[model samples]
Target chain A: MTEVATFLFSAIRVSTPLVYAAIAAVITQQAGLLNMAVESMMLSAALAGVMISGATQSALLGVLGGVFFAVLIAMVIWYSAFIMKCDLYLVSISMNAGLVGGTVFVMYLATKQKANTIGYIMSKTVGKLDIPILKDIPFFGEILSGQNIMTYVAVIAVAVTWFLIYKTKLGLRIRSVGENPSAAESVGINPVKLYGISFALSGVMAGLGGVYMSMGLMSYFARDMVAGRGMIGVSAMNVANASPAGSALFAMLFGVSDTIANYMQIIGIQPQLIAAFPYAATIVLMAILAYVQHRRYQKYLAKKLSQSGFEI
Target chain B: MNKVRKIESIFELARIILALAIAYGLSLLCLILVTEDPLEAVYMFAIGPFTSMRRFGQVVVKFIPYALCGVGMCFMYASNRFSMFGEGAYLMSGCFVAVVAFLLEPFNLPLLVMLPILLIVGGFFGGLIGFTPAALGAKLKLNELVTSTMLNYVCLYFSLWILKVYLADPDITFFASRLLPDNVRLPQILDRSTIHAGLFIAPIFIVIAVIIFFRTRLGFSIRICGSNRDFAKFSGINYYKSIIWAHTIGGVLVGIGACVDLLGIYDRYLWNEITNYGFYGLVSAVLARKNPIFAPLGAFLLAYMHTGASILNYTSEVPIEFVQIMQALLILLISAQTFLRKTKNKLIFKDSQDAIMKEGKTA
Candidate 1:
């Protein structure tokens, strides 16, 4: 039971960054943007957090710095895609490619190490929060009480994302823009402004995920440390059809598989094979989701046709 | 209509040149920030590739893969399907070709017999991988970009697993497959360089791609579907078939690229990462404006810059990763619809005015 509790704790801990990334993806997806550059945002943010924390010796400043860099990248992407009139998808792809190299370039300039900032700099870690009453419980407390502060923020982020999407006027405008941009413009809402807002919000969420990665989870920035987590989150958002709650659930599912892969590596499974599981599983789940969605659409079409008295 | 097209192509060329200049300026800025002698680094980066025959040969060798994948990407982009399957296709096909060569080595086949078979296997395997995301996108409406990227990771690890399980070179310390047989390795064409027979092979594939893209009905259908979907639909074009064929044919070219690249460059199967050849290919295709005939020009520019970056790597403190950032900038600026929108509009406007006056005089 204790071992199971430990596993659950690690799984939730692992899912924290993913949850943040899913929220980021969900926001842009809701705005009808692909936002594949979420990966790049998180990456640059991770490196920024490390550099700032190491330089300033303040984790809070590091978090703020990281968020700032992520938002700046978001604005750059917005400028190129919107102001410069570049293809949004192509811009996102270029941002992903550019920012990774940009981060590495910055990191090498700062630390003179091309690989990581493990020993070259002294950086503060984000504090872990232990709940008071919840800490008294046995297995459940162990799973729920003590986690990185970012984990708690991630939980709140999901709730806030739900509330912001469903209960706010801005949310209504964003949705209207996504549904039909020309219609939204006819009604006096600028889709471009909403896209910029969505990009900023997503940048903040991705920034938090990156901060958690370097300052909370690992205590230092490693080159390409975010790995495929950003993409995994994007896939989660896709599987959930851009719903905040559903995205979190899918993220947790990936988290569980990721935890299992880690343990499998310890049990003598080839690391390469074990590492492939999450990506392979994501593809399978996405395929299944697509199939189910397709069927639902077909059923809806059939129902509408039958109601209109049209023959099959 | 012809005058407009001619004007548009001219503007397109101008956009590419301007994009290249800005990207180079950004790279130079990065070099200035890093190096003690900025001018020397800049000089080496800009002009070093042309200074030495060996370095120029390196550019030619690198150009082979980039041009091959770039031509392939033209087909994919022509159909408006932005699938990233080319990356996975090349890696998987390269591994498959390596494995097949290992199997075929026992027959003592000559180079004439062995090379074509390996190329066929590679191209076929890549097409199979390519068909997956195409089908998923066409039939299931999954995002080909995301699925194809995920599949690249799968292919990378799967290929590595295959190497470890079936063909690990016990002699080598790294997790690489055994070296290919002597007869299967591509013969060097240059006197004192790594430039191989692939220098000829890449152009052949490029020519074939050009013919397929410009001279074929299927290519026409793909272009029509991409440029105007409703028109294609009303015209009774098969959208799904065009999408699938575009990706599959692109996959075949990418697979051939992988085969040729492996044969030209490596003695053993040792790829451990998703070589950004596919992404670069997509960038090349974009630079070409999805025209297969111009894809080589894009490929050559990228190869020259890459070779220059490597030269900087050897002589200066600057890392070659900056080239990626520059390449990204190049793609963004080149593809920006509004980069020089006013200038293009003005040129077209002037040309139309001139044409109208000429028509009036003729009448």
Candidate 2:
């Protein structure tokens, strides 16, 4: 029972960054943009979080700086995609690559280190929260309480994203612009402006996720530490069809797989094989999703053909 | 019509040059901002690659892998699939080349026989890895971008596993595969540099790519599908087959490129991290506008910039990562269809107006 609870606890801890990434993905995906630069955003933010917190010795300022940097990168991508009319995918891919290099450069400039900011900076970390009354409960409380504060924020982020996406008037405009930009433009909603807003919102989410990685998850920012989490978040968002709650659930699925892999490493599995497990699982999940979506599409096509009086 | 075409082509060329200049200028600005000795850093970055024969050879060495992968990417990009499996394919294929060399060492095959087998085996496995994401995308309608990116990591970890389990030299403290026999490694061709027989082998694949792109029916269909999927479907082209074949062909080239790089560059399989040649190749492909013919030119330009960046890294305080940022800026500026769209439109419009006025007078 304790083992299961412990596993669930770590799963939530691991899922926090992914949850934010999924939320970020959900926002952009709904705005009819496939933003792969969530990786870039998270990475920049993670570094910024470490740098700011280390410099100023304030975690709050660090959090803000992290989000700001992410949003700034998002705006750069937005300018390229919307203003300059570059291919979004190409822009994002380049941005991802550039930022990976840029972060190392910046880290090198500040800390004179290439690997991580472990010894050079005394970075302040975000505090974990132990929920009152909930901490008293047996298995469930042990799983839920005393997680990194970012984990709670991730939960709130999902709810806020759901509200922003489905319930608000801005949500309607975003969806309208995404669905048919020409129609939205005819109705006086600028798709380009909505795209900026979407990018900004996603940046904010990615920023929080990055902050969790550096300040909350680990004490210092490590080079390429976000690794494939941002991409995994993308995969999660893809699997969930861009629904906020669903994306979070899928993100949790990755967290579970990752946790299992980490455990498997301790149990004498090859480290490389263990490291490969989560990604392999992600591919399998994607394949399944693709198959299901294809089947659905075929069915829809068949129904449409029949309705149009075409021969079966 | 000819004048309009010439004007448009001139505009396209101008846009590319302007993009290149801006990226270079911005990268210089970054160096000036960060470095105490701005002039020294900028000088090295701009003129360093051409300073000596050895440096130029380094550019050529880098150029081989970049051009091979760039040409490979032309096929994938032409298919409009946005598949990024090339990075993984390159890394894994390179690893496999080493693995194959090690496995065949006991057989005592000659260089002529052994080299071809290694290249073929590497290409086959690379093609197999490339086939996965493309086939998935073609048949099941998966997003090739996501699947391919995921597969890249999977390939990385799998390669690491292979390196650890079977091939890692026990003597080396840091993890690396066993060294290949001297006969297995490609012979160096350049006098004062690391340029290998891969230089000769790279052109063969480039010629093959050129033939496939310009001379083949399959290439025509792939191009048609890329440009207009609905048109291709209406014209009865097998869309799935074209997508799969394009990616597989790309995968084959990427694999061969990996083998070339592995044999040409190193004595042992030293890559523990992603080599990033595949990603850099995408930049080359995009710079060439996805034309296989222009891939070598694009690759050469990038190789030069990369060599300069490394030069800057060693000679000054600036890091080699500066090139990556410049590459990103280059991709953005060059690929932006609207960057000089107005000027292009104006030139074409003026040419059309002139033609119309002349036609009116003739009539």
Best by lDDT: 2
lDDT, candidate 1, B1-363, per-residue tens: 898898788888899999899889988898988989999998999999999889999999999999999999999888887788987999899999999999988999999899899989989988877888999988888888888878888999998888888889998788788888898999998887789999888888789878888888998998999898889989999998888999998999999999999999899988888888888898899989999998888999999999999999898778778888988889888989998889889988998899899999999
Q: Candidate 2: which stretches are off by over 4 Å?
A: A296-311, B360-363
DockQ of 2: 0.80
DockQ of each: 0.78, 0.80
Model 2 lDDT tens row, B90-110:
878988888889888888888
Q: Pairs clashing in candidate 1? A: none
Per-model chain A TM: 0.98, 0.97
Q: Best DockQ goes to which candidate?
A: 2
Classify candidate 2 by CAPRI docking class.
high
Q: Interface RMSD values for the candidates, listed in order?
A: 1.0, 1.0
Q: Model 1's DockQ?
A: 0.78
How big is the positional error of residue B230 in model 2, measured in Å on the Cα after superposition?
A: 2.1
